[model samples]
Target chain A: MQFIEDANKQALEIMQTAQPTLVGMGIAKDVVPGMHKKLVMHAGPPITWDKMSGPLRGAVIGGLIYEGLAQTPEEAETLAASGEIEFDPCHHHNAVGPMAGVVTASMPVFIIENKTQGNFAYCTQNEGLGQVLRFGAYGPEVVEHLKWMEKTLYPILKEALEIHGPIDLKNLIAQSVQMGDEVHNRNKATTSLFIREMASSIVKTNSSREDQVKVFDFLNSNDHFALNLSMPAAKATMDPVGKVKHSTVVYTMCGNGTEFGVRVAALGDRWFTAPAEIIDGLYFPGYSMDDANPDIGDSCITETMGIGGFSMATAPAIVQF
Target chain B: MQFIEDANKQALEIMQTAQPTLVGMGIAKDVVPGMHKKLVMHAGPPITWDKMSGPLRGAVIGGLIYEGLAQTPEEAETLAASGEIEFDPCHHHNAVGPMAGVVTASMPVFIIENKTQGNFAYCTQNEGLGQVLRFGAYGPEVVEHLKWMEKTLYPILKEALEIHGPIDLKNLIAQSVQMGDEVHNRNKATTSLFIREMASSIVKTNSSREDQVKVFDFLNSNDHFALNLSMPAAKATMDPVGKVKHSTVVYTMCGNGTEFGVRVAALGDRWFTAPAEIIDGLYFPGYSMDDANPDIGDSCITETMGIGGFSMATAPAIVQF
Candidate 1:
């Protein structure tokens, strides 16, 4: 019991002191450990193509097309069923993703580093709300947007980050918390603060005026733009905690559309999983529980460190939404 | 009393419905009515060169150097003593300014339009905190910074405004209130929101990356940047309210470094004046009440509109500062 208590204290201390800084960005295949052209990383526990939920399958189809491995949904489905493409949890690759959380070879990802522990974590840029690839909608528009992000947004942000050096996410998250942001569902203040911090560096980049304006407009329009950063910040922070031996602390919590899973600090690589639940909360017009995907995404990692829903009182405005 | 009540109701209605929009920017002599090359504007009620406070005199000297009217502070002082500059209150020309509140020919000013009333108000860009022209410190660095604003900040903002059209200050203020900004001393939220709104247009402007980054860095560094805009917005909003016949609402309240003044709606342009009182509040390090300047600036226009100190509850964070 004493050993467990000491281990738990070590885990807590690691979580508290971890300084996650946004260092840079790169393509998933190049940056993420164990990532390769044929492997696709997703949210939560592993699943075969046959057992994947509708949203998960849709995202896989979209990812395949985005990667140029398949031409259409039918083609993507056949390729997925051919056993050539490897499916793995984002956790295995020191990464996390929101919603369907699919990461293909060519998609750009934010690289967050825990300066204290010398560890890195990765997450893709958020595509914003509604009809996005994350939410299982994969039309031509979605693929085009992804390509634009790869070609336009990626280079601009990468250049800006070089000018800015490393941005301290811990300080940003702390400031957002004081400004009534839980750093989860209500990220208006967080996004605005990020825009303020990045605006200077972004302007200094060699990108064209049109491309620069497009980046600013894209960031300004998406209140959830920082969600991707916060996820990896959380990932980078929590990953070190799992290295504490005999710790009973729970670090990783996420759901694929089909299964919910959590990893305990002491358990190393093993996972405890259950059936994913349907979310029962407010929905957009013409949508209800029946239209909902099973609870999904690596976003619950925010709560593992005791923010998000655990500290919802900090963001009273979220209730109105 | 009943007639006064009805007139006050009219004034309040006009104030409530006023939509102040930031339309553009221009040199004082070109845009502001009655602004001439020899004429200069100070805050609050009318005053002569001899009666101006130290800070006011400092700003005037800086303005002279910036306008190329005088080469040094000694020459500026001699010119002022010789009565070459015609000094008047900013209110006389439908304008407002903070701190020392000095405006001179060739100084760039923001054009705020009351879309509801079709009237305009103007104010110069904020020079940021400490040893700047607004506080009346006219060092060479101050002069150079002012020149940079004139040559660099002005042109980019002018071009950006053309592309952005009119930005709605009322809506922005309403949102900032919810985000904990009184839009006076605590304009952190207001300034952040403004940056987010303008970043797109700023990036789209033809200015070089160096100039664009300078603009963003200046704005990002100044938390009180929107104070300049808010004062003009309040001025534009209240100017229309004064046009209501028989209205008894106390609309205009401001202070020159030497005197405090107020104007009621029914009283037309007449001002009731008293000797200015020194401000009694927190001060920066190495300064105290002993070093306090007499109450100054047209910033009370915000308080007249029931914001600033009047709506302090909305911004609890101000108390910390």
Candidate 2:
């Protein structure tokens, strides 16, 4: 009982005092420590190429192409078959992602720091929707958008941040929760707030008005722009509370397309696994449950941090969806 | 009954469609459309100099010094005694303020436009706490802060805004309501969100790092910076809903320190007034209820807009107060 009380105290301290901030934007390899060539970060827990689902496999192929190691899906498939590309869980690298959560070396990642604890976490930028790398479709359009985000969006945000400095994201997330964002799945308020805060910086930092316009249009058009930042922000805050010796609290909740996995604090990094469930929700036009993938991605970090599914009552907007 | 339903319909349309945007910032004269020398804008419904409260009188005298029309409080008092400065309600000029809401010609005002209705509203920037003009303190320090806001803070925001472009404030306000801000006295979320949104533009547009630091420090330090903007945003949204024929719905609620006033939609700007109530709440250190002024300013616009005190149940943080 005493141990339980002490663990609760430690968890409370992390939850109450952790200050997560949006420090900057960077590519995975440069920002993520110890990221080596041919290494890929996927969603959920550790899984091999053979155990990978269709979408996960597709994402791995997409990641290979994104990293310029493969030009064609067929070549990428050959490499995956040969076990040349090393696949790893994003959590292993102190990173997380959505869907297949394939993060390659060159992919742009949101850098979130837990200022209170002096630790950091990373997540790849959300690719909006439809035929994107996270969802496993890597068409030419996906490739183009990724390249544009790297070349155009990255530099503008980088320069703007240089002028603006770091943003206290935990404060924002808490406020956003009050404003109608569950901080997972429903992020309309946070995204708009993000746009409002960064719009001017993006404009003044960019020498060209066209770039500013493009950046503004892109950010506003995508409601999920803050999701990437929110994910890592959650991780940065929760990381401190994790790994307690006898804490019964769940630290990490995620999926690798094929299975749902969670890391219990008492069990250290040992993952408790379950079979993945089919996502039961409204789908896009012309798409049905048949086309839907299993619940995948590291997004359950929100739930782990106590706001997503765990606090659905507070965010009825997302619950309705 | 039919007329009442129609008025409600109109009110709903305004509340639903009114898209207020923070278009720009400028001097009261430049932004308020009509201007003449010696005119002053105060909070709430109209009142003569003889009927004004102690704080109202002090703010008026401060305005004189701020405008360089008078050098001392005694001289400003004489000018007021002589009726040389014409005082009018800020609402009459399509503007609003909190407390002793005095707006001189040279005072900097946030310019908000209802993009949907194609109308504008204005409010002076919050002077922050302490010996400030809004609370009726016209000391040299107060005068100095107002001048610095005009000379430094105003221009930096202006340039950053020019680079950033118009902000959809209506969306932000709605989101703020969801986030725990009643959009009246508790605007912490909106203010932080505003800071996050504007920090970068402020950084990039300003040539001096020190100036950028000052602007950031000033804005970040003052949680009420967005309060002024929020009032005008509310007014802009509610204005079109106002003045409907034969409707009992309240359109504007405000106070002039001495009296509380409400404008019904059917009244068409005809204010229904009552003796002001003494503010009963937690006071600053060394101050008691007797030292506090009557409930004042155009802040009750939030209640008229259906948040503020009306929806305190949704914002428990404020309800606790």
Candidate 3:
């Protein structure tokens, strides 16, 4: 009991003091070390194409299409099955993604620094709901949006940041929580705060007013702008605390569509894994629970940080929704 | 008693729902209606040159110098004595200022709109701390900083804002209060949040990187950047509530160096004035409490809005400071 109490103290201290800052945005191959051609980072623990869940496999096909590695989904599927591409979990590269969480070398990623611990984490830009690459429904629109983000939004944001400097995500998160956001499933407040913070810098960049409006309009229209940011921030915040020995506290939690996995502080990098439970929520139109994949993505990072599902009590309104 | 209760309820409702948004920044002549070339605005109720305090007189001199109406403090004093420079309280012009709170033509000012009420308010940029225009010391250095703010900082912020859009100060104030700021004498958190929100946009503007750094460095070093904004926000918040008739609740309070004044809701803009009491706080080195100026500035707006001194119980740590 004493050991558990001491461990809980250290875990709580890390949760309390974690300071995540949004430092920059850049290409995966350029910013993320060890990222190279033919290397793909996906959500959850390592899994092969044979064992990959349907949504995960769909996301990989979409990634291939986005990277222009294949002319069609069938070709991409064939190449993926041939095992010619190297696949690793996003966690291994200090990166995270939602749903299928497929990350290719060319994708843009947010750079989050754990200022308190001097470590870093990364997450791809949120594709924004319905038919996004993360959820495995990669179509022409997904590819176009991803390309647009890469070509226009990413560089403008980079220049704007060069002018402004890093943003302290911990401070933003605290403000968001107070404004009624758990920051995982419901990021309305954080997203608005992010837009408010970035709007000024985005306007000052070399981008045209039309382009700036496009960015702002997209951000204003979507309430998930901070979802990717929160994931990386949570991961960075929990990293150092996870290293405390003899601590029984949970440090990391995730799902890969096929398995639910958690990293316990005492066990170091070892993952405790189990079959992912069937998702039991209402689905979109033309979709049913039968079509649902098991729990997936790196979003559990929010839960690990004591937000998301863990903070449901503070957000009865969202629970009602 | 019932009338007072109704007025208090109205004030509370306004305080709870006031939405002050920073819509623009511009020259006073262009932004503030009826702000002509020769008119000057000061803090608190109207007072003649003979009745003004030393610091107030000194600040008026500084304003004259900054406006190029006079070349020297002696020349500025002569102009005031001649009664050629018309002096009106800032409150009359939908503006507020701290201490001497002097404003002259050509100085840049923030344009804040109360979106809920469709009314507006104005305030000049902060001159920072020590030996500044608002505090009554208008040295060459004071004039220099004021000119720089007008020429450089103001335009960049203006352009940046044009690109981004208006910022809601009511939202910012709510967040600041939660983060340990009464936003009157202690605006540490509000200042940091403002810099964070503006840094990126300030960077994107036409200003050179070096100039941007100068602006950022100045803002980073000073914690009073939000003081000017807070004053205008408070005024805007209380404006609607102050319109309630036959109510005895105080709507606004301020002091020039020579007279303290209150405006009751039932009395409209008519000021009830008394001799301004000398401040009794500990003095700086080489100065006794006797050297302290009478309670001055339009900062009483914060207290009127139920913050600052009125919210002291919410912040014990600041009381210790």
lDDT of each: 0.89, 0.81, 0.82
Lowest-scoring 10 consecutive residues by lDDT in candidate 3 chain B? B312-321
Model 1 chain A scores worst on lDDT over the 10 consecutive residues at A312-321
For DockQ, the strongest prediction is 1
Among incorrect, acceptable, medium and high, the docking class of model 2 is: incorrect
lDDT of model 2 at residue B144?
A: 98
Query: For model 1 chain B, where is the 10-residue window of minimal lDDT?
Result: B312-321
Candidate 3 chain A, run of 10 with poorest lDDT? A312-321
Interface RMSD of 3: 7.0
Candidate 1 residue-wise lDDT, A1-321, digit = tens:
899999999999999999999999999999999999888899988888998998888999999999999999899999999999999999899999998999998999999999999999999998876678888877888999999999999998998899888999999888777666787787777788889889988877877778888999988888888889888999999999888999999999999999999999999889899999999988889999998889988998889878888767757476222
CAPRI accuracy category, model 3: incorrect
Point out the higher-scoring one by TM-score: 2 or 3.
2
Interface DockQ per candidate? 0.63, 0.18, 0.07
Give the C-alpha miss distance for residue A110 in model 3, angstroms.
Answer: 4.5
**Residue-level lDDT tens digits of model 2 in B60-83:** 999999999899999998898787
Poorest stretch of ten by lDDT in candidate 2 chain B? B312-321
TM-score winner between 1 and 2, please give it. Answer: 1
Which interface RMSD values do the candidates have, in the order shown? 1.4, 6.0, 7.0
Q: On lDDT, who's better, 2 or 3? A: 3
**Clashing residue pairs in candidate 1 (N, C-alpha, C atoms within 3 angstroms):** none
Summarize candidate 3's per-residue lDDT along B216-274 as a digit string, tens digits: 66675666778899999998877777687877768789999899999988889899999
